[model samples]
Target: MTITHRFLQIAAVAMLLGGCTSKPIYNAQENFSSNMGISENQMQRAIVTALHDRQWKIQSVKPGQIEAEITVRGRHHAEVDIPYSPTSFEIRYRSSWGLDYKNGEIHGNYNRWVNRLRDNVLKELSIDPNIEALNNLGAVKRDVESPSYFAFQEGVERATQAGLLDGSIQFYLSGQPVPGSAHHIRTVTSSRKTNGANKSDKDACIWALQSALVALQSAAKKAGANAVIDIASIDQRSLYKDANNYQCNAGTFMASVALRGELVTLK
Candidate 1:
């Protein structure tokens, strides 16, 4: 081949490889403003709820700041730090693992997550008055008349009495038994609902899990067990109607969820 032709061919190959390998500049910080006429507290709650909907574990929450961790498929993980005020918020990429790039460029999935999270937060911030009223009324009625309501309170009391309601319970989403343990106890469920306004499905889900855990603790105390396992959300049903179920639903103004799990004693 001629020298000129060979040089051109090598340059073309290099260009193609560079184009293929080039990474998009990572947007480390995503800024958002609330023009939906919601208060700062409401906005923060919505953000937290959005994170919860995405299964992000909240590490810490301050007046205007939140730190959360996202785990994808039990392998890939990332940390997001959100700082907010009455009018603005920022979703900042803190750190990541199992992603291809380090700082300048981030994996596409990370961007996608932050974007999706922003969308969800915005949705939660949007307000609807009629729906809010209905949700509030429903919540009030449930508190006054729902058998599950009383059961939940009773469970909380029992758990408190037994000193098992502390956030020390080991929770497993998968229905897997703890290693080196082999004793079965009864399954327990709990459910909770959130007032539609200023709350998101994520917030409701977190509350539902807390209620469910209290119920689980109550059941464990009754069964004389030490731990609960395979904690998970379940569909709302008549069987779970009296027990708070951990199935989260979000509407114009309110959010709700039901949770279920098995109480067990670890060996």
Candidate 2:
């Protein structure tokens, strides 16, 4: 539909004609509210309840693709300055897939399962105030598939919708959680080199730092992190103890915290 779709299609075809194969893009889908997963009605209820339970009055829920931020909540009515001032809530849901080529065909698999899972991962208002549920939109770390599927959906959005994927399309969504939200927002970035996946130099060190810098920048903006240290912060002695002999045509991206905005808070 857009220039991107056209470009990607062209690129995929070009690679195929060159006797190369590209990863087929998996499709992410959002099932109706009546599906087995959490319904929009239920999600809406959960969001509203989460806000109300936390003393954050519900303002509105915009279900559109264009809005930069999705859901918007307001403080208590007492905090209302205008007819609709600062929303007390902001929730957004997006899903996408990677482009994969199999048998000379692009595969667009439906990823609604993740959408369902995401809907079910509602805020745990019951958690203690000290404990917070920090779910990064892009912070996907997992040994799992469903959640990873969801992350793929979001990644596609970044590439297609958010315009983050200008280079080759990547298969991300580790489906694991880093450690804490306070550390930073979850972001995945990659870079590839020749020499066949060496664990020593550029593939391990310089290239890693380059990718990390990109990830850090992306995380900062996407996660709204407060600040980030120099790429040197990632102890060169550790992060990439092995970089030489980088994977030939093999790409690697290190996930890191992005931003530290005051987005997540207990009710």
Candidate 3:
């Protein structure tokens, strides 16, 4: 494990200990100097897009503000209000259920969800296109359970159902033979995230893996390749090659999968 991941794991353990007594309530009122020149309508659209992408249901909408809520795995729920102008927006925590809220403190996952909302808003506004980097900036805290791993096929069905992968584009993992005469097109990496609130680690990992597969599939299609071969986990720059399984890191709020593979066309 990288130092950063190790540090996050240690910090999560500390947070768990603190949670035995009281955690902290999270509220965000962010000012965006960078988006000053944008219009109020644009700000609203950005916020709405971010909210939708994160699966937050819009409760109410008006001229300068909106109320939204999310229920995770039919268990945890959170509500927040976004009051925005052309200059900035705020994600103020409203209420929650099934998250151990008491004496002004709530579950750590609440903060992560809100923070991710904030970052996604920034992403919708910013010109930078590195989503993984933005996600990294937002989800700094780790879950009590920091990491999880799973088999390659464990996520394949879900990925196929989600239209992220298909038999048209085959995925050959490391040490798995590439059938037919295949010409390598390029090597690419995909990193993807899935919300982990109240979800099983395996399920979250699979969702994330599905997204990563989609990214690779997109790249392969773009390069006119029919397959992605020699896939391996390259999280934090360390390679974990396997013919069957891949690696995923699951925390309280998010699960992430990063994969590298060579795009190839079988002739």
Candidate 4:
């Protein structure tokens, strides 16, 4: 028979085996801004983080909604619509593949995935991104590489392995030396969100710096430049020039780092 008929037959057999069933669609309300006084932006961030943690790819984002899709093991796929407000949000079923959805019924696994996503969102919303929490956790560097700190060399190595960057490109701070003969291309800035949820400020700052370096290298390559020079921290529009360290804002859920540098070609 046709592929469609074959699929339907398989689904019918699966249904007969009780692997699929009808379930009420999940809708979450009061998931935000009750006693916490969170804004819509904060609610959006939490939801985004939760989705990322749950391996959901955001398909599109609108002012009041986010469309996301999740693929399980390159076979089953599910899509969801999340329309949110400062006071509430709802997760509605949009579509699915390999789930045998019919007449408002679907494989029981779909319900379980939605339920897990809801639980993660709730947990993320309840977390306090307070800087103090990270500070109290102590331990200065050493012992083990903190998940927060981004080692520069390690970052470079990773980029090289991924074929995105090379060691031939030089990176320098504002006070570092660049060959006087090098031709300046254009100045560029790279900013990245830091993982500040449960990381220490110092570690988060390091990670942000590493992330910025990778961006700069990518930009330089795109511009046919061999180096990024005169790097300066311009986070929040406040410029800080340091030879050995960059500036980072680490606290709460919004840790970030921004670096500006001149892209140049060396002889």
Candidate 5:
């Protein structure tokens, strides 16, 4: 073969390889299955709770099916369809935004969220134990309050007081202003975590944001400020961590989100 032809052939092969590597492999459909031996009514309740806990709004519901929507900071949004029976259920992806997608693949985040939902559903289903012995034990404890229980309660109060001293704060997203005019305070940030075993990614995101808000509010209060203002750029710090940022990570049975934002006062 001519040298020119040989070079052209090599270039074509390289181009083909590049195209293949540029696209990631993803599943066209993602689903989760659970068999908790719960009644249909109970299962539906659990499903709703799982979605609500993650900030998902239930758009519609009927026998053996649920439709929900998830919107992240008015940016990324997703629709999820869940169908279940008396003893089993499945969470399936319907659509999404701000995520990688192709004919058959979706961004990994979608799968993570679904998995978290499944875990939460199972947790809710297990809340009502069917074991007679466990039920009896719980009943006895409820009937007979112990002295140590009061002491434990006191300890909880002390812990709460300590948390307040840690300088926690509340924050508002952009456009969600405090009641009246407020001054602009320094930007503040905070974060929280969930093990993904008992909590979903949505729950982790909420907790992280809540923690950050608490810290921000605490700082503002110390500054004699009543509320924060112009809160913007709410997000998850999937790659980098900083003082004013939000991010989430997931593993087999672990998930966490870090949140950060500017602290401003409403004047």
Candidate 6:
């Protein structure tokens, strides 16, 4: 049978089995998103629609109908930036008295995300280039690749194992008070140690991983290596490579995640 047919067959089987365990299913999906068959537009649209369906009362694009409170919340640590990653905006609703009442305290959440699933939607219009690309990509799958943080972090880890380097590598010139590399990264996941981190930590973690990668790449270039190779997946880094179990203060609200990778001789 053709690959597509085989896919349908496998899907049918999975449906018959009530779908595989969440763990395996997610594992298989991770392979797919990290490698193939994922759409950023679809992700963003689905998120927006899901939120509209759950609330917002009227859901169409009436333009002037919705009131968007666009305000400058001041210059915050321009939170680490990444490319082509998915983010979330979750609004928790609870009746002031209980779930049945409309007078409850309702609040909205805003988070940065990438290459992974998050539990909220981002209503902020002031998004970076990567985020804008994600929102505008639409329902069709677009062939694109920007940069990977996980890859860089893995390079650092590999370097450590090889006795070539030491110390935490910050991808952003973030740690150093100087303008580090102008490079950008996309974090795909993060650890639960981040107090408010829910299942959505993956997006932040991927950003962190990308940060390390860019930093390491710069370091590697300085070390005379042409490139870094064989970067580990975010899940792998979180499970096996990270030493602190993500307990330290990585940054304000950013999870304390340590990743590793290696530099290779140029081909």
lDDT winner: 3
Q: Estimate each model's TM-score.
A: 0.38, 0.19, 0.48, 0.42, 0.37, 0.22
| Candidate closest to the true structure, highest TM-score | 3
Q: Each candidate's root-mean-square deviation in Å?
A: 15.5, 20.3, 17.2, 12.7, 16.8, 19.9
lDDT of each: 0.60, 0.29, 0.78, 0.69, 0.52, 0.32
Residue-wise lDDT of candidate 2 within 205-250, one digit each (tens)? Answer: 3333334334534545565554332111111111211111111111
Winner on TM-score (1 vs 4): 4
lDDT tens digits, residue span 128-233, model 5: 1222122244421223432011121222234356563233334444444356665665544443333445664445344434444556556677777665554432
Pull out the clashing pairs in model 4.
Answer: 148-203, 149-203
- Residue 253 error for model 6, in Å? 4.6
- Better candidate by lDDT, 2 or 4: 4
Cα shift from native, residue 70, model 2 (Å): 18
Please give the ranking of all candidate structures by lDDT, highest first, separated by commas.
3, 4, 1, 5, 6, 2
**Per-residue lDDT over 1-267 for candidate 4, one digit per residue giving the tens place of the 0 to 100 score:** 999999999999976787436565555544432534446886788789889998999998887899999999988898999998777777899999987777777777788888777767755554322322233442222223322323344544555676655676788787877776779997677766566668877667656666777788888889999998887665221356766666655556546666677899988
Ranking by TM-score: 3, 4, 1, 5, 6, 2
On residues 64-164, what C-alpha lDDT tens digit does candidate 3 reach at each position? 99999999999999998899987778998888898888888888888889888887886665422243453455461253444466889768777887766
Residue 158, candidate 1: how far off, in angstroms?
56
Please, what are the lDDT tens digits per residue for candidate 1 over residues 157-204?
455566657744545443343665747776565555556566544454
Looking at model 1, residue 214 earns an lDDT score of: 64
